[model samples]
Target: MRIYKVGGAVRDRLLGKPVTDIDWVVVGTTTEEMLAKGFRPVGADFPVFLHPKSGEEYALARTERKSGRGYGGFTFHASPEVTLEEDLIRRDLTINAMAEDDQQNLTDPYHGQRDLEARVLRHVSPAFAEDPLRVLRVARFAARYAELGFNVAPETLELMRQLSESGELEALTAERSWKEISRALMEDQPQVFLEVLRACGALRVLMPEVDALFGVPQPEAHHPEIDTGVHTLSVLEQAARHEQPLTVRWACLLHDLGKGLTPEEEWPRHIAHEFNGLKLIKAVNERFKAPRDCQELALLVGEYHTHGHRALELKPSTLLELLQSFDVYRRPQRFEEFIAACEMDARGRKGLEQRSYPQADYLRGAATAARSVAVQPLLEKGFKGPELGEAIKRERLKALKVYKEST
Candidate 1:
């Protein structure tokens, strides 16, 4: 068997990036030969084996043909006769299709190295349209390599547009779709991911709420960017710039969904847009099966982010209500994430990215003051049952009032 390292490891190495995972393609190898050599069979749909000593994956060179719908619709054929060229042609991008032998020799059947040097993300073959999942994958690669000035080839984006317009993107599984989205959100240039998806018309098919935001206008007095969709992407960009967690990033992405639903007569003023956006937020969170923390933070940001932005101006009672809604006493980290998401929203506007968001500090101070209210004092003062709850609430409110006054 002739072994060659392939996919991201080779691509990243060629780009002078640190390779984290190594995948091997074994050409001229049969499943029985692999098993006899002590490789552990692990693939369910194709011929894949685990190295006996290294524990690395070794997939037999294989080719696929699109037989039906979605990404999983493809049927694979792996045999000892399968050539390395045949296997490389099936990859999603030209950058990932190159292979390297143990002797450090390069194989460039599809000109992946040439595309790499040109900083282009090109498809290996016309068969790129076969798998709807590659559309997301291509966008994600753009997010990853955007800092290096890499972009999707125009022809590749045309194919992506064709896939999106074909209605195939809707057939992808939620789990698979979420995997690419969440990864893209964490990239150094995540805004590029959403932009590429929108450019290719995939955003409308997969996330219409976000897509609808493109032409929608916001209050120019507050949002210099004007476009709700542009602001949404800027918010995600700010979250990434601050190295935020996934929950905060997810919340940032969904924070302005209500703006998309604003009436045309309202134009730039989306009064009660926060409440209008809650249902859309819930739908998106449910669609992707976001983690419970992510969902809760997103919901809180969706409904109360405006309150967070106006923390200094809000009454103590309103501030307390917001904190209580977040269960700030139970999940402090989530509350921090909520504040960060709000801060990103505030900074997302053009020319305001560097402005101070004192609202976050005020909210943090309010939470600390409320938490400082001693429950032991109330319990010792004959408080019990619902009365104890009321007593604690009253005391917390009193502390918040004093804190707000002092501030």
Candidate 2:
């Protein structure tokens, strides 16, 4: 058996990036050969083994044929006869299809190295359309390499559009789709992920709530971008620029979804879009099987992001209520994420990216003041039961009042 370092490790290495993990493709190997050589058999759908020493995955060189619909509807053939070239042709992108031999020699049967040097994300074969999941994967790769000036080949995007129109994207599993989306959100140009998806019409199938925002108008006075969809993408871009955590990025992405639900007569003014957006955010969570933390933060941001922007104008009682709504005392980290999401929204408008968001600092101060209303002091005062809860609330409200007055 011959081992070749393959996939992301080889691709990243060629791009002069620090390889995080190494995957190996074994040629001229059978399952019995791997097991006899001390490799642990681990694959479920195909022949994959774990290295006895390094613990890295070693998948036997295999070929796949589309037998039905969706990504899962594929037949795999892994035999000692399968060539390395046959395996590489099955990959989604040209940049990811190349493999490196143990002697560090490159194998480019599909011209992956050429596409990588050209900064293009091209499909390895026409069979790219066979897997609906490749649409999301291609968009994710665009997001990952966007900072490096890489773009999806126009032909690849056209193929994605065909896949989208074929209604195959709807067959993708929620967990699988979320994996690509969350990873894309963490990339350097997360907005490009949405843009590419939208360009190919996959966004409408996978996330209609977000897709609805594209043509929806927002108050141009506040959002120089004018389009709610554009504004949302801007928010995601801002979150990525800050290198915010996944929770914050998710919140930013869903924050303006309500604007799409506004009455058309209302046009530019989405008076209660925050409250209107809560249902859409919840629907997105339900569709994607989003994590509780992501759904909770998105819900909070959807329902209260406007309150954050109007923080200075809100009554002291309202400020305390907002802080209480987020359970800031117990989950201060989440509250921080909420503020960061709101700040990203405020700065996401066209030509305002560098503008200051004093609301963040103001809310932070309010939270600090509210938390400073020590529960120890109330406990020492013999407060207990329902009355204790009321007492703590009163103290927090009072402290928040003082903070509000100072601000």
Candidate 3:
């Protein structure tokens, strides 16, 4: 049997990138032969094994044919006769279809190296359309390598468009879609992933609320980009550029869903879009069953981002109300996350990316000042129950007032 390194390991190495994991394809090998050689069987759907010593994945070279619908509708064929080239061709992208031999000799039956050099994300074969998941995979690759100037090949994009229109995208499970989306959100250019999906029409099927924002106009004075969807992407880009964590980025992504629901006659003025966005954010969170932290932050940003923008102009009582709304003493980090997402939203507009957002510091200082109010002193003053709560609020409000005056 001849074993060759395949898939991401070979592709990453060819691109002069660090290879994180290696997958081996064993050609001219049978399942019985592999079992005899001390490899543990692990693949439920096909012939995959874990090497006894290295513990890396090793699959017998196999080929599959579409037998039904969605990702599960496939029949696999693996045997000693299955060639390495056949296995490679089953990959989703040309850049990922290259393999390398034990002697480090490269195999390029599909010219993956050429596509990689050209910075093109091309599908390996027509079979790429067979699996609906490839649409998300292609978009994800667009996000991952966007900094390196990689773009989706026209033909591949057309295939994605066809899949999107065929309703095949709808057949994907929400969990699978979320896996792609969450990973894409953490990419260096997460907006590109959404943009590519939107371009291919998959956004309507997967994230219709986000898709609805595309033609929706925002107040031009506030959002020079005009289009709510464009502004959303801009905010997501800013979030990434700021190196914000995934929770903050996720909040940035869903913060403006309310704008999409604004009445067209209202045009650019979405007076209550902040509150309007709350239900949409909750819907997205429930659809994907997103992490509780991500859901909470998105909800908080959706409801209070406008308050965050107007933080510096608020009265002390209003400022205290906002700070209390976050329950900052219990989860101060969430307050920081909320500020980061709001900063991204404010900076997301055209020509405002580098502008200062003092509101963040203002709110942060307000939170700190309120936290510094002594609860022990209030209790020692013979306060209890509702009176204790009332006294603490009064003290925190006073502290906020002092902070506001100092500023």
Candidate 4:
């Protein structure tokens, strides 16, 4: 059993990044041989084994063929005849293609180390386009490494463009697409992914709902022609600036996706846009195979504006009741995230110079205050059954009245 450290672990170590996961490549080893040696078999399409003690994954060195399209269109071969160099050559990026032996000997036939030093994201070979999933992976990598000044190779970008144009992107499952997008959103600079996707024409094909937002003018009150896409990007940037959780960031990035489907005539006054966006957000969640909590957060962001606007007029009891309607504990960070989304959206308006109301500051301060007051004894009286519920309800109403009178 020749064990060689491979992929992200080696790349991250070279880049001085934290290594969270480790993958091993076993050359000249069969799955049956691995099983006999006490490794637990795992992979179905590919031959991967789990170490009985460490639990780290060890995959047999293999090569793939694109028998279909999208993520599921591939067949893997892990026979002893498969060479380590051939396995590395089939990887999407050069930086991820390099491997290191148990004794720390390096094997980099693709010059992945050179690209890593230069901060470039180059394909392992011209054959990178064989797997359509590589396009999304490259775009995601661009987002993650934007701070390092990494740029995708021109040839690689061209192949991505070709794959996107050839409808290979459409073959990708929503879950696969979401996985790439989710990682991109979690990056410090997610706009890089969007920019790369736009350049490659993949954004429009893969997420046409979002692509439709480009250049769609907002009300004259919005400066810089803030379309849905621009607004979404702005929200994402704001979320990143605040260093919010991943779910919040994703919600902000996709908050206004439904605005594109709204009629052009209602551009700025999209009163029902939140509801519309929620449907699209749910569809996206299902497509991407997001967890239930994540879906809730995304949907919450989609309807954040409505909730914030309603909060302004709600009594304390009504507000608490409304807040209690959600599984807030399961997503403890959502309140802050909702506020962040609202703040970004409000600030991006065009006619801020002409507006009559203090919408931005009001939304910010109100959301903040609501969060603070909702934790008070009156709001959290620990009531359970009918009597407890009634008492809590009474306290909430009284509190709301006092708040309204003070305002």
Candidate 5:
């Protein structure tokens, strides 16, 4: 059996980037033979094994034909006759279809190297449309390589549009879609992923709320971008630029869903949109099965992000209510992430990318002030049971009042 390094390992190496993991494709190998050689079987749908020493995945060279719908609908053929070229051709992108031999000889049957040099993201074959997941994968690759000036080939994007319209994208399971969406959200240019998806008509299929934001108007004074959709992407981009965590990024993406529901008669004004968007954020969170932390943070940011922006102007009692809503006493990091998401929204305007967000510091100070109130003092004063709870709340409010006055 001949084993060759394949997929992202070879692609990243060719781009002069770091390779985090290595995938091996083995040709001329049988399941029985692989089992006899000490590789542990792992692949449920196909013949894939884990190396006994390195623990890296080594999948047998195989070919698959579409047998049903969605990404999992496929029948695979793996045998001694299955060639490495056949396996490589089934990859989603040309740049990901190259392989390297033990001698470090690169094989480019699909001209992946050429596309790499050209800085284009092209499909390996028409089979690209067979799997709906490729649409997200291509968009993700676009996001990852956007800073490198790489773009999806026009023809490939056309195929993506076709796939988006074919009703196939809807067949993809939400969990699988979330896997791609969350990963793209963490990429260097997360907004590009959404943009490419929108360009190829997939955004409406995948994230209709976000897609609806396009063409929707916003107050030009506050959002120089004017288009709510453009501003949403700008906020997501700001989340990535600040190297914010995934929860914050996810919050940035969904925080403006209510704005999309604004009545056109109202034009640029979306009063009480935060409350209007709470349900939409919950819908998105449930749709993707986002992590509990991510869901909680998204909801908090969606409903109270305006409160974050109005931090300095809020009454002390209101400030304490906001802090209590975040449960900041026990989970301060989530509070910090919430503030970061709000800051991203504030900075996502057309010409305000570098503008200061004093709201963040003000909110942090309020949280600190509330936390500074000692519960031990109330205990010493004979405050007990539910009365102690009231006393602690009163003291915290007093501290926040002092902080507000000082600010």
Candidate 6:
């Protein structure tokens, strides 16, 4: 049997990117043969084995037939009859279909080398639609390679559209959807993925709440001609450009989803959109099966704008009390994440930068100052746990009182 390095490791190595993981396809090897040779068989649905000595995965080169539906409904064939070329032909993308021999000799059966050189994401076969998860993977690849000027093949996008219309996406579990979206949101240019989904009609299927943002009118005083959908994309683009953390980025993307739910007539006069937005964010999180921590942070982002507004109006004692109430020391990134979300929200609106909103600036400054304060030092002092807690509470109240009187 001949072992061949395949997939991302080969693609990434060719691109001079850091190769963090390696996947190998062993041709001319049967499961029983591999087992006899001391490979640990691990795959339940396919013939994948782990090298007993190297601890790296070594999958038998196999061909697949669509026997069921969605991602899990596939029958695999692994035998001496399956060639390395046949194995490479079944990959999702041409760039990922290249293989390397043990001597590091490159094999490009489908001009995958050309696609890689061209920086294009092209499907290896028309059978790519057999697996719905490939759509998400292609979207993610587009997002990652946008800066490199890579574009998905037109025919491949057409296939994605067919898959979306075929109801295959409906078979996806909430956890699987979240897994792909979470990774997409974490990309440096998430708009590429979002745009792809939008083009393929998958966004409407996978995340209708976000898709609903498109074309929903925003107040003319605050924004340009774009609706809430366009504004949301703008905010997400800004976050991606800034290299913000995943939570902050996701918050920016979903920050304005509530606007779609709000009445257009009350656009400029609405007073509780943040409150409205928080509920919507929670619903969206639960729909996507976001973890508790993600749900809480998303809710925080929805409420963040309101909190900053309150901070601006509060007196020093109340402000301090508010700060003290939150365990900012332990969850220090929380406030910064909130501020980042709010900044993107404000910047996302047109002419808001010139509008008189000193409250945003004031609260942002306060959060920054609060972060530097060593709250734990006070805790470490002779003050007992209850005393320290009470002292902090009293100090915060005093600060709020003082700020209110001064304002």
| Candidate 5 residue lDDT tens string, 1-407 | 99999999999999999999999999997999999999999958879999989999999999999999998989999999999899999999999999999898999999999999999999999999999999999999999999999999999999999999999998998899999999999999999999999999999988898898999998888889999999999999999999999999999999999988999998889999999999989988888889999999999999999999888889999998999999899999999999999999999999899999999899999999998988887899999999998999999999998998898
What tens-digit string does per-residue lDDT give for candidate 6 at 1-407? 99999999999999888999999999986889999989998958778888999999999888999998778888888898899999999999999999998788999998988998898899999889999988899999999888888999999999999999999998877788889888998888888899999989898888787897887776676677458787787777777776788788777877766776777677644467667777778777887788776666677777556566456666665566455544565776676677767776666665453334466556645545545544576777767668886766565555445445654
Q: Model-by-model lDDT, in order?
A: 0.93, 0.92, 0.93, 0.75, 0.94, 0.79
Per-model TM-score on C-alpha atoms: 0.99, 0.97, 0.96, 0.82, 0.99, 0.85
Candidate 5 has its poorest 10 consecutive residues by lDDT at 43-52
Q: In candidate 6, which residue ranges exceed 4 Å CA deviation?
A: 267-271, 309-330, 349-394, 401-407
Question: How many collisions between residues are there in candidate 4?
Answer: 5
Per-residue alpha-carbon lDDT of candidate 3 for residues 285-317, written as tens digits (9 for 90 to 100): 998888899999999999999999999889999
User: Which candidate would rank higher by lDDT, 2 or 5?
Assistant: 5
Candidate 6 vs. truth: CA RMSD? Answer: 4.0
Per-model clash counts, in order, read 0, 0, 0, 5, 0, 12
Global lDDT of model 2: 0.92
Model 6, TM vs. native: 0.85
Q: Judged by lDDT relative to the true structure, which candidate is superior, 2 or 6?
A: 2
Clash pairs for candidate 5: none
Model 4 steric clash pairs: 221-350, 221-351, 222-350, 223-350, 316-400
The alpha-carbon RMSD values of the candidates against the true structure, listed in the order shown, are 0.9, 1.2, 1.5, 4.7, 0.9, 4.0
Better candidate number, 1 or 2, judged by TM-score: 1
lDDT of 3: 0.93
Clashing pairs in 3: none
Tens digits of per-residue lDDT for model 1, 309-382: 88999998998998899888988888899999999999999999999999988999999999998888888899
